[model samples]
Target: MSDYQVFIGGSAGSIAPVITILSSLPADFNLTITIVIHSGTDSKVSISEILANHSALTVIEIIDKEQFNPNTVYVAPSGYHLYVENKHHFSLSVDRKEYYSRPAINVTFSSAAEAFGEYCIAILLSGANEDGAEGLLKVKRHGGITIAQSPKSSQVDIMPQSAIDNRAANKILSPKEIISLLLEYNDLA
Candidate 1:
């Protein structure tokens, strides 16, 4: 987890697991965590604030062209497609929705693979749709490690299952297992 940048994507019943993982990490965790969740346009929920309250790491809704830093948790803003413009900054767009989602998981995950390559670690969690599979595949092809939440552990199995089906995930793990693996990576770092 030293120079690695992690991208997590989820929908439907993913919040609880996200909180669990974030809260379990140390304050000095040395990786950048970027998250994308589908909350829809009509929703006014503040996911960044909610995550911030549950974790020791700093959490913020990503601002357009924001410069990213390690140890911070960045949540993609709703209704915009979040992209890693480069290794240092992020860009946002009102691009046409993919998989009926503006902040599509595929967009960020693919961008992260290009920007970080083998240093990228992407995780696709529970979701009702198939948004993340292709992007996760791209990451794996780029030599990045990709993990999909075990279907048995997901409240909604479609998303992670799609990744598994597409051969995108190098590992399929439960939430608890995911946390442990992350800590293991940190230890190696």
Candidate 2:
């Protein structure tokens, strides 16, 4: 089976759904997940820690030039842009923010599209801005499957709606549907 990498991006009201998706995956699931969420520098709690509490798989806050592994969840660090350097590693940059936020979804999603191509599954979740729309489009153009959180399920519809509006999302689904689809993809991988 081909290696599948899942890239998820979100901002407002995305954490709960992310936890739901991760917690549902078994410990031995044979896929990698990388996440980028727009966050301010002053976040009081560690997102990775929160995710780890809910998930059976290991959850890590990505470090610069860190190697990636399957069956693990990686969360992008705040105040930097996350880039998938290749299939096996990630690189971080402190470049200027996009869409008024650092760790912009666009940077990571676009990088994943380049690095993983058709092996990637890109999901755009709830957010307040249009940051991830173009990146999701790139993922689609690269032959990756792209999904947008259904506006009905999103706390803030602008993010996924933008992807849908741009015709980038191949599927628009609720959180439960997203988890089901991801589990199916894991089986294929």
| Cα lDDT computed for each candidate against the true fold | 0.93, 0.92
lDDT of 1 by residue, 53-77 (tens): 9998999899999998877999999
lDDT of 2 by residue, 60-108 (tens): 9999998978878899988889999988799999899889988999999
Clashes of each: 0, 0
Task: State every prediction's TM-score relative to the real structure.
Answer: 0.97, 0.97
Model 2: lDDT of residue 70 = 80
* Candidate 2: Cα lDDT at 117: 92
Error of 1 at 169 (Å): 0.6
Worst 10 residues of 1 by lDDT: 38-47
User: Which of the numbered candidates is closest to the native, going by highest lDDT?
Assistant: 1
Error of 2 at 136 (Å): 0.3
